[model samples]
Target: MRERAVSGHPDRPGRTPGVTLPSVTERKGTTNESGVRAERQGTAGRLPALAHESPATAFGDYRAAFHSARLPMALLDGDGLIIAANPAFGELLGTDPGRLTSAAAADLADLGSDPRLWTAYREVLCGRSDRLRCTRRLKHPAGQTLWVEVGVEPLPGGERFLLTVADSSDRHDLLARVRHLQMHDPVTRLPNRALFFERLSSALEAASFEPSGTGRIGLCYLDLDGFKAVNDTLGHRVGDRLLSAVAQRLSRCAERTGGRGGDASRGHLVARLGGDEFALLVENSAGTDQVAELAQCALDALQQPFDLAGQRLSVSASIGVVERTAAGTTATGLMQAADTTLYWAKEDGKARWTLFDPERNAHRMTRQALSSTLRPAVDRGEFTLEYQPLVGLGNGRAEGVEALVRWRHPQFGTLAPNRFIALAEENGSIVELGRWVLEAACRQARAWQLERPAARPLFVSVNVAVRQVWDSDLVADVAGILAATELPPELLQLELTESAVMGSAGRPLQALQALSDMGVRIAIDDFGTGYSNLAYLSRLPVSVLKLDGTFVSGFRSQEHPNPADETIVEALVSLAHRLGLTVTAECVESAEQAARLRRIGCDTGQGWLYARPLPPERITALLDADGRTDDF
Candidate 1:
C-alpha cells in the first residue's frame, strides 16, 4: 500500500472532495471579502496552502516524511490491520518495516493484553471514539523491555487510524528510582513507614475483596529494649550500626517465617518505622499462631550479641503480635493495637513477646476512664462510705467501725476502693477524696452518737493515703471535720498503712504526732504485711495495729489451725500491748477465726465474722436491734 495524500477537487476552489476544509471567510464569520483577505493575511505566516501542488508531488512528500521522520508512525486499516509502517516504527519494535505489513497493530506492542486498552483501540478504528492514548510495556526482539506511549487517531474519511508510539523508558525508570528512595529508610535500607502502611492498606483491601485469600492479616511490632542506654553510653555511630544489624536479623526472621511452603512471594514485609522501631507485616496470615511464631523468631534472633566496630554488645527486643480477620480492620486500628501490645510486652519485663488481649486492653481502658473521671466523681458525690464494725475481743461489743469507701459509678455501677484508690492517689486526687471521707465519717459517727447517747459511741476509722499527708494539710482537715461534726477527736481514728508510717520522720511523722496531740487516735493499717518493723513502732504515736488479712485467714480451720500463724499473731499482740498499741485482726471470716483471734488477746477485730461492710441504715438497724450485736 502507498501513503495516502490530501488532494483537492477540480470543481471546488481550494477544498478536497470527501474532506471538508472551511475557508477563512467561513471560519471567521466574515461576509465581506476585504475582512477575509485581512484575516488570511494575519495568519499567512503560520498557515501555508498546499492546494496548488499536484497529487503526485504531495504523495511523494508524504511517503518521504513517513519513511524518514524520527517519530514512530503506522497506518492501520478499519479492521486494526497494519497497512503500512515507517522505518522508525520498525526500529521501535526491532523488526523490519517490510515484515510488519498486514500485522495487527495491537499485537505488535502487546497492547491487547489489557482488555480496556484493547477495546479503546478498536473503538478508535471503528470511529466510535475520536482518539485512544495510553502507555504500554512492550518487549523488543533484542530482549529489552520498552515503555511506550501509544496514541491512535482517526484519519481523513474516518476509515483508517494513525498510530503513534513515543519511548518513555527513561521517564519510567526515573520515577521508579525516586519512589524507591522515598519509600525506604536511609540507615536500615528497608521499607520505611510510608511503604509499610501502603502495603498494609493494600493487603487489607485485597483480603476484603478476594475470596481465595486467607481473610486474615498479621503484624509484629517491636523495638530494641534498653536501646536508649546504648545511644547514651556509646555514640550514635555505634547506635546506628546496632540498629542496622538488628534490622538485618529481623529481615531474615521475616523471610524464614514467610517462606513456610517454599513460596517467596508469600514472604512478609520488614520495615524500619523510625529509630529502633521495626514492623513485619504478613499479608495473608493464617492465625495468631503464625504471627506469634514470627515474633518468637525475631526475639530469638535479637537475643544474640552484635559486634559493631570491635565492640560486642548484647541487646534484646520486645515484640507485640497481632493477627485477626481483615473484615472491619483498618491500617490505623491495626497499628494502634500493635503499639499497645508492644507497651504491654515492655511492661511485662521486656525481652519478650506479647499477643494482643482484648480483655487486658479493656481493663487498661477502664482504668484510664476511671482515672480521668475520679476528681469529677468526687465533686458529683459518687463516693459513699460503708462501715465495717470493729468489735472488742474482751466484751464482743462493737468498739469502732472502719470506713471503707465505695464509688457508685453511674456507668460501671458500684466500684470498691480497690478499683480506683490507687488511681486517685497517682493523680493527686486522693487528698480531696480523703477529705470527703473524713468529714462524712465524722458526721455519720456524730449521727450514730446522737442515736445512742447512752451507749458507748463507735469511733470511725478512715484510711489515709500517704499522698494525703504530703499533698494536703491533714492535721487541719481532721481538726476542722471533728470540730464541725462536734465529734470528739478521740472518736475519729485515722489509719495509715505500715509502709507509709515505717520511715515516718518528715512531714508525715509531724502530722501524725500533731493529730495525736489533739486527742485523736492514730492506727497503723495492714501492720504485718509491710515493713514489719516492730521496733520502729515505738517512735510514732500510732495507738492501734490492724493486722493484715493474711494472718487472720490462717486461723480459719480449728482442727488444722496454723500453729505458726497463731504463734506469730500472739507474739505480735503481746508486743503491741507492751508498746501501748491495741491490736485489731482483719478478715476474720468465721467464728473459729474470731475465737482464735480473741484467744490470742487481739484487742479488736474487723471482718465478715462480725459483719461485712454495711450501709449506714443497716448499721442503724443493728444499733437499734441491740447495743452491740455479734452479727447482723
Candidate 2:
C-alpha cells in the first residue's frame, strides 16, 4: 500500500482537478486573517515540494498529520486495542502517547463498562456503520469527569478504526452557568419567579394526572411589613443588605420545616418573587397544618433584628398560606389566592399568618368590586342621598336632617354609606363623592325651604370624610355648592368625624374656620367614638356635637342604665352647651331613649325613633304636614 503525499484531499491520490487547498505552510495561521491561532492546529510537520512523489514521504506526511491534529485522534485494531494515539489524546487523558497506544480507548475513558458505548463500538468495528459520534464521559485518575464528544470512523479495510475526541467541558460549564442565572436571583441567590412558576406548574400538572387526594401543594406568600418605609428612610444600599439577610433567614426556615417524608418533588422551595415579596412553595403538603407551621417558622425567623451596616433594624412579615390538592388547582390561581390572603394578614395586623378563607375573600372581592365601581357610579348617577330627620327633643319638631349617601349598586341592591365609604376614601374617590353629596344635600334643602314658605328652613347636615377635608378644596367646594343651590349657609351643616376635627389644627383647621366664617356650621359627627380629645375640642370653631350611637344605647335600660355611658353623654352635652355648641344624640331608637336624651339636655336627636333616613320626596311630604312641626 502506497502512502502518497496528499496535499489536498486526504482520500484522493492527487490534488483535486482545478480546485486548490491551502498548502500546509499557508494554512498554518487561523482560518480568518486574524493573527489568532485557528481552532484546529495545522499538521505539525510538512513535507517539502521535492518529496511529493515518494511513498516514504507520503507516510511521513500522514504520520505528522495524525500527531498534529489538535483534536485528540487515535487508531484502533479489530481487537479494540489502541494501536496509535496523538499527543492531544495523551494530553486529554493525562498520559503519554506510548502508554495510550497499548491502552484500549475504553480503558482510558472507562467506556467499556457502559453497555451502550460498547454496543456502538462493536457495531462500527463489524462494518455495520461507517462512523458514529456521541458524547461520553472521561474518567480521570483525580476523581474528575471530563465531557468529550467522541467520533469513530471505520477504516477502509474494516480491520482498523480512527477515533477523534473533542473536549466539551468548557461548553457544558458555560451552559450550566447560564441555566443557573435563569433560575436564580442574583442578589440573594434564591430561586426566582420564573423557576418557581415552572416548578409549581409541573407539580400541578403531575397532580392533575394522579388519583384524588394524592398530590397537594401549599404556598406561603410573604411580604416584609413596613419595608418600603425602611427603604425610603435608610437608603437602598441598606435596604438591599437587609433584604439579603432576610433571604438567609427565610432559606433556613425552608430547610427546617421541610422534614424528610415526601417524594423527590416534595420539598420546600423558597423563592423571591421580587422586591420585598418572597414565597415558599411546598410540595406534598400534609395539609393546612403543615403550611401554618411553616408560616409561623418564617415569622419567627424574621423577628430578630437585621444587622445591616452596623444598624440593627427590626422587621416583621405578613404571610398568606394556601393549601389544596393540585388536581384542580393552578399556579396562577394559587399565587392569586396567596396574595389576597397576604393582604388579610396585613389588615389583621402584621407579624402573623392568615390562611385563605373563601367567605372572607368573597366579601372582600365584593368590597373591591364596589370600590372599583364608585367613580363610574358617581358619573353614572348611581348614587342617591336619603335624609334622616334630626328632631328637637324638647318640642318633637324636625330641627335638621342628616344627609346619608347610599349606593344604588345594580347587582347588590341599595347599600349604606358604611359599605363602601372607607374604600372610596382609601382610593381617593371620596373627594369627588363628597362634593356630589354636598351639592345634592344643599339642593334638596333649598327645594324643601322653597316648598314651605311658612316653616323654618331645616338645616341639612352632610357627612364629610377626613380625606375629603384634606385632599379636596372643601371651603371652595362648599361656597360654590351653596351659591349654586341658593341654600343659605346657616341651613347647611358639614359634619366631620370626631377624629377628623381633633386632628385639624393646621391647614385643615384653617379650612374649617374659613367655612365657619362663611356661616356654614361645622359639626363634629360621631363624637366620643374616637380620641375624644376634650382639651382641644373647645379650641375649634365647631358649632354642633353629634354624640355617637354608642352613648345612646345606654339609655335603653332606664331602670338600671349604664351610668358611665350616661355620665359621659351628660358631660359631652354640658361641655358643648358651655361652648355655645348645639348637641345632637344619634340612634335614639326608643321613645325612652329620646326622653332620656331630652332630660340630659340634648337639643336634637336622630335615629329610627324620629324616622329612618327617607328619600327627598318623603321628606318633602313631611315638610308639607302642618307647617313641618307635626312631621316627626
TM-score of 1: 0.83
Q: TM-score of every model?
A: 0.83, 0.69
Candidate 1 runs further than 4 Å off: 1-87, 96-135, 150-164, 260-266
For residue 253, give model 1's deviation from the true position in Å.
Answer: 2.1
Residue lDDT tens for model 2, 1-632: 32212111122222111111122233343243321123223322222112234545644657777778888887765545455678898788776665554344555544455566666666676676677787766665456778888888876545557888888999988987898899888887788888888888987887767675358889999999999988899999899888888888888888888632111144788888899999888877889999999899999999988878888899999999999878779788898999999999999988899999999989988988998888999999999999888888988878788899999999999999889999999999999899999999999999988888787778999999888878888999999999999899999999998888896778899999999999989899889888888887778989999899988999997787898988988988998898899999989899899888899899998888778888888887777663243445
Q: Give the TM-score of candidate 2.
A: 0.69
Query: Which pairs of residues collide in candidate 1?
Result: none
Full-model lDDT for every candidate: 0.81, 0.79
Q: What is the lDDT of residue 401 in candidate 2?
A: 88
- The candidate that achieves the highest lDDT relative to the unseen native structure: 1
Worst 10 residues of 1 by lDDT: 14-23
